[model samples]
Target chain A: MASYLPTPDLSHLKSADYHNVYEPAEDSFLLLDALELEAPFLNDQLQPRWCLEVGAGSGIVSTFLAGQVLGSRAVDFGTCFVVTDLNPRALPVTQATWARNGLALHRLHCIQTDFIRGWRPAAQGFDVLVFNPPYVVTSPEEVGSQPRGRGGIDGRQVIDQFLPIVPTILSDRGVFYLVLIEQNRPQEIISIMRDQYGLLGSIVAQRKAGIEYLYIVKFSRDTSTT
Target chain B: MRLLTHNMLQCHVKSCNDPALNFPLQFQEVELEQIEAEENEALLLNLVGKIDWPALVQTTSELGITGLPPTKPDVVKNDPALMKRLHEILLETNVAQGKMVCRGCGHSYPIKDGIPNMLLAEHEI
Candidate 1:
């Protein structure tokens, strides 16, 4: 007799039926993991500052910051997260994230934006910038209408576009936090930021998920006058 | 338009008369918007092989979508970190107000109002 294995059940892991892109159960765990890493960098003293989160998937990271990290804000942190995405279908989940967590609506502002074309912010608007972009490094024919993860050919396309204009969009003293894979040519992205875009930073955290390595990075702008 | 579109674009330079030259249409003017979606780890698993990594990175970087995954993850199953990054890349970034230039032919297609004008001249087609 030959040994046989059953096909994995993938539908259960697909997008939730009610919400567009959020999986409440799965993301809740991921959010906790992100907070575990981000908390040290986002010290409690940094509260009451305006923050912008470019990619607020299911509002997990922001909700974590508001609830677990920020604790209760006396002055409300003046933090306003700008959650953006290309798919108009996913907005409701981000809105519901705060609602589910009992966070105030005033603390969040959602935007349907295209990260590729770039973004414009009010002068000196954000104190912190957080992003978790798609860096799958795929081909054009592959990313067909799928939401949430579409990195082009070399996997650095999104990063290249972003580093150049980060200075322009970020507040002068703003801190940047992000996650990327350690396996691929991440040096390519860092080089663009340091050599080309002028952002300076080192990997602040690292974790292994099975065979893949994940890196948490944080950087600050130079104190020189622009 | 997204970098996915950019990868397919090519310039309609003087000597290149191929129809494929009209690819990777350029953007003229566009209205950008961002929306967040739920995390679909399964799709990330499926799409891992579907994407044009270099083009996606190039277009997003050129368009200013930073903070993406460094490369396509090998084992994306049950990995929270990888899935989280997948959520950000797929749902959060937008491509408004720009055009993709063809690397081959150098033709320009303008994106206006969030829609790409992928039309081509008579000769190019």
Candidate 2:
């Protein structure tokens, strides 16, 4: 069946809010499309119990996943959705997005932390993880600077910091979806996940938007018994 | 703050690393408000496995709201009344105003206008 999850009502967010928090754009919608493509697998096969969205800006992506994919299940599957962002202003916006979608705050949690630095109780790894990192190639100093969408030299600074910890933070059957541009060296990232982390990576969806070719790369632990 | 959000939160203070002291931050003073929301039993059941039931029970008790059993009952799936109560605890009840105090470090995080202030000082970060 074609996925028909309604795009969340973000009309509640005003331009003033967008000044600091990210406005939903093509990159965000592309991530939503990728998730929609895998909705059936996520719903029936994975039955994901815990989902984490890193750098959840407008909170639209994670909200969609909770409201559309998992929420469609007949059983009260109770998926816990947690989101983290470096921008403190993004937390409230994320919460508003959740409220706007008729989803309560009970199953959703938002924390204003940088790149999972304070993540403790390591044993409680997530079953589904998604990240739409800043992949624009820019000066190194711009990585964490104000207007926080710049990815440092090679456009992989944030991605690099998050990659090594994937295996450690993911459950045995967990799947991670990440967004990257061609400039970020997608092949090297796929290789690193395979050769170093023992996780298989593949591009699940890609689209050329303007000058940037965006890809949604999905990774999971290599479970093939060969 | 919803109990679901409270369930995942821990005291992130730098010196407060002890697990026992971190979780289920004590709700010192809270203002409760109920907002109507669409009921979805499937979503509620989906959340049961992820919630720390005992922590939730303790939090509700501390907040002076009781009726949750000491532990999560296996019959929740068969009991609609229990499921409805769970829905109220998790989704309907909101912490409108209050402060969440860390049990270990004794740091207080305030809630204003239904939003919890989780930002820590530079030294805490």
Candidate 3:
């Protein structure tokens, strides 16, 4: 009788070390959800010219925007976005995704930046800032360096860092669209923008995901009030 | 670009305080390619914060290229001229051939074609 031997499973070993293993389903869903909100913002002419996507992990949102901007049936005069992420490895992959989708390479620019410190867009401000921040409320260890799902201790560190810069980076009539977990301090985020940043804000979209509630916020800086 | 190079490139480098070992130079042996294309004004303005414009200007000048715009725009709303200049600086200009050396740390990073080799020594690591 021949000896029975089993092959070693090398599946666990991949050449690259990523902060988070790629999950196509979750990623695609996030993109679709965010787009559901953004599409109307663009379609309704409520800041249709340019957009920005913070925490653009694998470039799914960037790729989709490029297609919408450069496709044959582009709706607006022009649409472009700056995709920013902290992971350097994500840059080329983001670029590749756009190319793979036959989107105009010009419609997207990828950047590597740490949002914890803060970010200043190459442009002073954006018409629309779309953010799907990491909001898993957990301890530091649970949310250390993984770029996709880790938010500092209470899941508000990233949001807090971004709050102060809202005035510095958004157009006068711009809106910030974001999704946060139910556990996140949504009232706190809104109050900071309203009281500190001096912008009128509201939660435009919300959906429950298990125990967490995903939300979309829109803010406008009315110069008349200022 | 070498992390060492990137480290040395600081907005405050013109006037250093302490810990200035990594100041001004770095290396990469890479190919230079310039692809002319439309400049996305919105994107360039967004990148203003991420780029070390002055350092980039100096570095590109060292490479005998005068690509970046002399002036930044007050507003980046649909400005064709600004967009053209931004396009040249961000996309057209390439760091394809040379090594980047830190003016402060005396560290060197080699470049192959247009890609930068940012690996560090074992001890440095």
Candidate 4:
């Protein structure tokens, strides 16, 4: 596969940083690839002003959007990127990742909060929102120890809660990209988003990375309805 | 947190619902810094549509940032000067270290190293 955009430089993150923040893995890159596929539509059509990564860990995904997807693919430098993480340590790590990548800070901001509760966007809403959740299936007990590590019961714990809020968080032209594993039941999630929330949902791309059947699910406003 | 981000933040405590009280989280003991960046005139014009003009005025006044007109200025005018100034305050000014106190719930969210922590306690949630 020919790579159109260069991958973001996350070399600034040290080994110790991974202790608290999640290290970029196959899942992160897959989300980046999915976004890259939509770069044309995003830059040309949507031209999102406000973007966010719900659980930006090492900030690799956000860095990719800021540097490669939004910045280089087009000249939309004004597009603001907001990164939020439940883990406090992830905040600084994500900040450092963007800084090391030479991204301008005027459009990059970080906050610590759970979900979109802390997010307070106006009518424009989040034009592009991405979340690569913890899709490793594990017992409920495991979820407590690792919030971003394993999803309790089919890795749907966080994703389920996050699904309902997508419509509310997204703008009329906004599109959301979410990553999930096979155990996470991607089809069912798509239906729930469409039927329940009035969003048009579908899997953009799915690839098998190692043993995990990674899927990138995209949800956008159902223009047909209105 | 930048002024643009702070403008959107509000008191989301489950019990706090009043718009007047919840919104425009008050900055306290803030360590402000000016981090320069390339100016984007189009961005400034685009942001004007959604930015809370009144809230921005109140915030700037509260933070002792003067010279801003109470109403939203015409960044789209022939003058590039207003756009540059707004680009600085709205995007460049950083809230390095401080706490944002909610006018309604009296909840305080802390800011350290340019990131604001809005995670509430279980009870607050």
CAPRI tier for the interface of model 2 = acceptable
Better of 3 and 4 by DockQ: 4
For model 3, the stretches where C-alpha displacement exceeds 4 angstroms are A1-31, A43-50, A69-80, A116-123, B1-31, B36-60, B66-90, B95-125
How does residue B59 of candidate 3 score in lDDT? 63
**Model 1 lDDT per residue over A104-218, tens place:** 5434545454542322122233557776666556785554223556657655566555676676666666777666766336666666667655677667655665654666566
Model 1 Cα shift for residue A180 (angstroms): 0.8
Residue A114, model 4: lDDT of: 82
lDDT of 4 by residue, B10-112 (tens): 8888898888888888999999999887777666666666678888889999999976778875544566776777788888899999999999989999998
Deviation from native of the Cα of residue A12 in model 4, angstroms:
1.4
TM-scores for all candidates?
0.54, 0.83, 0.65, 0.94
As for lDDT, the candidate ahead, 2 or 3, is: 2
Model 4 C-alpha lDDT per residue in residues A1-226, reported as the tens digit of each score: 3457888887787787777878778888888888889888888888888898988788888888878888854245457777888888887888888889887767677888887676664543788999988788989777732335678898888788888888888888889999999999999998888889989888887889899999999999889957
Model 3 per-residue lDDT tens digits across residues B1-125: 22212322321222322333343453345455665555544545544434555555666666566745555445644666656665575655555456656565556655443333344433553
Measured with DockQ on alpha carbons, how good is candidate 3? 0.12
**Chain A TM-score from candidate 2:** 0.94
CA lDDT scores, all candidates in order: 0.52, 0.80, 0.55, 0.82
Ranking of predictions according to DockQ: 4, 2, 3, 1
The full ranking of all candidates by TM-score, starting with the best, is 4, 2, 3, 1
Ranking by lDDT: 4, 2, 3, 1
Candidate 2, backbone clash total:
6
